[model samples]
Target: MAHDTGSSLTRIFAPAKPPAGAKAGTVGEAADAKPPVVVSLSASAPAAPAPAGAPAAKSFAEVTTDARAALDANLARMKESGRTLGMGANQGSQADIDAAFQGMDRRSLHAIASNSGGLFSKDEQAFAQTVMSQQLVEATGMDDPAGFQRDPARGFLAGVRFLDTVSAEEKASDNWRLNRAVAQTNYESSMTRDHPGEKAENVDSGDPVVNFLAQTIRSKEGTWTSVHDGSYVDDLSRITLFKDGTDASGLQKARQGAGTATRDAAARIDITL
Candidate 1:
């Protein structure tokens, strides 16, 4: 995102302001003292609707057979990957299952996606995101209240703002360089050839997700006029695009390519905020 030199929102860093207090790592300590309560998490798409006119199986035998077949397929997939069934990551392990609902009412957590205690709850569902979101952070196998307050996204956004607020002297250090690699990859790109009648053109999205894509072309350009010309506030327009529901479709729209409007100055202040 190498852009021309006159950018306000897009920059090497943001203006500095001393924190109201020291960098408080005390969130963890204070969280430990609070009894874990059931919370609802709505960070992603909502539950899928049940199939229309699809009747339940006639008996327990059918249910058993279906479950067994599903497990067999999962096992086969594991075998192909050479991964142990109980291995780490988001693999649906019994241990992972146990920790996902940790510190909350067991029965309540069990009714996830179907009830108020589902993933949207502040209880078990939210806790699961922390343990499973990172590779280095192991599944504690203990569902406790302390991990709940350490909201990963908040921590990340806090760090982002903090980095923006730091002096250039602090930003150029070794610590910040490594942190750059940790930024999530959410960009998408590709080459395409069309029929004779179709126009050929390049598609570059200034969308936030596209900017942070995991699989990307990895261009060297920084936030610039030709790269992502729009202001940083363009992200709010993406958010505004999906104000109705948090369904899969909504998520897709909310994360659509922002490149088309990346240079449109009018879009910056267009959202509800």
Candidate 2:
């Protein structure tokens, strides 16, 4: 009984044999069966490697993000250096600012420099313009495109040139006082006409004074005007010539004082006669 236990279990569990005369590799009716095909459920293969020496192209979103990050760092550095963010009256070299804006795309630079959101400072705008102007010249061999006709840097540069020309002319003229008065009157009248309500003290108003000066300088009148509305060039003189100050030298009051002095001299000569 003890010895028959293993034999009985084996007999019950063992598979049945094939019938007689069956093929060597087949069992019973499985003679025509085929091997199963294998399939894999693994993940897809990785993307092919990029070609050698090819630059990885960035998506628009990535390009914008990188541009903004660089802009933030640039602004932070400018702020740490004690530069104001929105005033155009501040005077300083733009070399550092231009360096900061280098490598930025033209679209982002133009958008930021446009100051449509009023976030960029005047210096930053000017710096961006300088970079853009350089880029335009390099690309086209000319920097006078109509697209940048309203560029602030161009406006400011024009104003500086007008001032230099006037100063040089007035220096050699005997009627320098009258000539200056006329020149100043022309600028004031043109600016007042173009930017009606904009005050020179408000440099935050997108440098309207400088823009007006540029517009007038480039106009058919070319900074010459027959209209005198009693508006003084005091603010323009300070911002353009002195860079920053409340110097009243550009005021029309000087013209009035000159007239009074001339009349006084006439009266003194008449009394002597």
Candidate 3:
């Protein structure tokens, strides 16, 4: 008798399909009993490409340009808000002032001046004029005589001499008021206050009078040395001799005036001294 291979045990242990072209009865019976389950695994679809001619992400240059534009707009708004941009409020030295005025053109100066509706107080105008004068001096090598009176380094004496000279000249001039006002403002702002033991020479003196005398002597001697040579005073020296004493220029001017007076006296009386 033929063995019955298509039994339940054969279906559990035998191959799922029969060999190619083999008699199908043996394995077909098993395959037909229970078919293999089919599983379909699909790969994910690729991402879509970006559209052509569309704007790309911004580069570093574009980003930087945008930031700079915003900054400039903010500065323009501040300027329109009636603020002083470069008027030297924080500047304490001539060098600092000069640096602030650097790269400033006439248009820029006008803009800065008119930022507050073109209305400036006397002090404001004076300060503006001082800045302009400094620029002019730097560019043309011409000194503003009034500026020397306002220079702190020229000391107190130079300031007084400058005031005296300007005062006498202004008496004959029609613009006396304006000149006097500017000069007075500059003098007041530039005057140095003396303190006890401020200078090296004043440190050893116990009495105030003695200290004053000693300071005076030191100032005079310094001024004289700065102006005087062995034979005569140097006419072209620019060194300031005193903050409270006569400078080289003032001494020269005094000498000239004295010589004129002496000559006039001699012409009348023929007197020798």
Candidate 4:
């Protein structure tokens, strides 16, 4: 008789099939007869977003791919314009070009995208009022040290600084008391400590002093009187108001009459006797 394959020996030559509820194969039998496994894996990892204010980081391969595409478009346009062009019809290896762009830096990319593409002609110093550094240079017409030269972004920043400086100067010089009621009282009390000297100098500047002095006179902080038949004025008024004048008995009495207060200067009188 012919020898049977394992399947024929086990299944066909053996007893009839077992009931569906019964166990089929032993654990070891199933383990040894396991099928080959087929695993499927994706080609690349998922992307991660960069955080705010952070520049996005990219691999050399990714960057090179973008740079090559952009340079290709540029070459095409130059050829169409018939101004002369180069670069092969085939796309560049993104790896090499991306390496170059990454090495160049952010500003270089900006320059290439901007100036090479004839961008910013309308956006910058295209007019007189432009705050471009070149415009500032033209307006100020300064020369020599290149620092005085204009650039759009820097000129704008400098002009803002200039305006801030001017505003500070005006605040110092004008002394425009923004809170006048509070400032006025503080100033008045300080100035009237003395008058007609350095203390007065602190208060009266043109109209302020004149107005202050007039105010002092009305407030009687400044006073005028007749003493020893002399006219005496005191802001730090006179030290003494009355002095003994000789009467018939030769007794001295303070009179409502003029006293010796005027000893520092001339005396005044009106005689009705």
Candidate 5:
């Protein structure tokens, strides 16, 4: 018998094709024969690209950090130029501070205001308070921007004297109502409760309520006998009007007054009142 070496070798090396009815990828006549498995060792698919012209959004923490850094840089620049904030021999102008504040947004200002760290000086703290207060008025069109008073001596804290009355939640609150309430209460207490030695009339509490009441009463004193007769003692005594708090009788009147004031303030700024 003559051996066909080439054909024999081909038969041995290459697998035999499955019989006619067999499924694809299988070899031989056995019904149980499995196809050879293939696995890829290739790298993973690439991630999809971001949309065109859209920048990555920042987190609250990142925004706050950026705000603080910008504030520091601005202060540093001012210092380098031999100027400083607040009342001093070489005090920086309000324009300088306002320009620096342009880098910050409402959230950034909120974060800065909520901070209790010694990172900011009294004047810086005062500036932040003033700016935030104004922003609140501008944004919410609420009355009593002056309610958010600052001493530039002790900074605008959330409570009476040294005691912080506002909870952490309230301090962190974005709600304008809560902010106004806290500011107003703190201001009121600073005038009446905090200073016991001084007469309410003589004390310049930086409180808008007291100021408004006092000014209104004094201006009306010339016309209204009730104020001139000293029955209420002084214009500051009009704060008693708010003494009722949220009583049923007072609530509506209070709301009406607040609404009117808010509208007036917003009107002066030429915004929605």
Candidate 6:
């Protein structure tokens, strides 16, 4: 499938004002001061109507098989690129990795990286972590609701770290970074439904899933620009995808090609066996 490069959105998160009695410039204060701004990256292409005599949607088993194949192929490519699939920094043993993989669904695998605390020792493992984390968070809420509320920033920072550590090569080819972002956005969207009347406005985007993806793409592009422009130092310490409100800067549109490619590949799987 041809990749689309121009389909990205841009969003800006303006700094928030400090709460009353809080010291100016404290981390919490600064975070509280930022307001999120979301702009549409691109209008979503309308879903095409099924063609006459188009094959039925693949069964869940077929879909799962196809996903596994894509994952295996991607993993092989990563291995060829000198990436290692070994234990992460904090993982105790190969058994740990194996156990983690056992009985886990693709989404769970996708969500692993984000929840792994950034302890991966190799790029391939990091990629795996993202895939696993994406899956896991979507299946499960972003941790317990109370815990998430207590420190939502932690989850957001972990996501940023995953994106930041993605190899440029992987980002360009596998599009894992974009996929991870999309997955996280989807998770956040689900979280909004799970909790009512709690900073609902703060997290509001026309569509949380799409907006979250758009915001992530913008944040990544901004980081790259800031690094090269010499106007601001690149810092990943306080990464935030949501602020006063969320905004998009057109990155999501550019990355949609990758997402489409993934879906198409899975949809084409032959499950006659």
Model 6 alpha-carbon drift over 4 Å, by segment: 1-131, 134-141, 173-175, 179-273
Task: Give the top-scoring candidate (TM-score).
Answer: 5
Candidate number with the higher lDDT (4 or 5): 5
Encode model 3's per-residue lDDT on 229-257: one tens digit a residue. 21111122322323334444444454455
Of the two candidates 5 and 6, the one with more favorable lDDT, higher being better, is: 5
Which candidate has the top score in lDDT? 5
The models' CA-based lDDT, in order, is: 0.28, 0.35, 0.30, 0.25, 0.37, 0.34
- The segments of candidate 5 whose C-alpha lies over 4 angstroms from its true place after superposition are 1-57, 87-92, 116-118, 139-171, 179-273
Colliding pairs, model 5 = none
Per-residue lDDT tens digits of candidate 5, residues 1-273?
122212221122112221223222211211233221111111121223568987875666666677688788877786788755543322344455565566565555545645534455544544554454333222221222233223311122222221122222323232322233333333434444445575433233333333344343333322222321211111222333334342334434444565576568679889643
**For model 1, how does the per-residue alpha-carbon lDDT over 163-233 read when each residue is reduced to its tens digit?**
33322322322222222212221111111111234432322223344333222214333322222222112
lDDT of 1 at 190: 11
**Steric collisions counted per model:** 27, 0, 4, 14, 0, 51
lDDT of 6 by residue, 124-220 (tens): 3443443233222222223233443454444443433344343223343223433345434433443454444544323322232334454654445
lDDT of 6: 0.34
> For each candidate, what TM-score against the reference?
0.19, 0.26, 0.18, 0.17, 0.33, 0.24
What TM-score does candidate 2 reach?
A: 0.26
- Model 4 misplacement above 4 A: 1-56, 85-145, 148-273
Ranking by lDDT: 5, 2, 6, 3, 1, 4
Looking at model 2, residue 120 earns an lDDT score of 61
Task: Give the number of colliding residue pairs in candidate 1.
Answer: 27
93 in model 2: Cα distance from truth in Å?
A: 3.2
Q: What is the lDDT of residue 174 in candidate 2?
A: 20
CA RMSD of all predictions: 20.0, 39.5, 44.5, 44.4, 35.6, 19.6
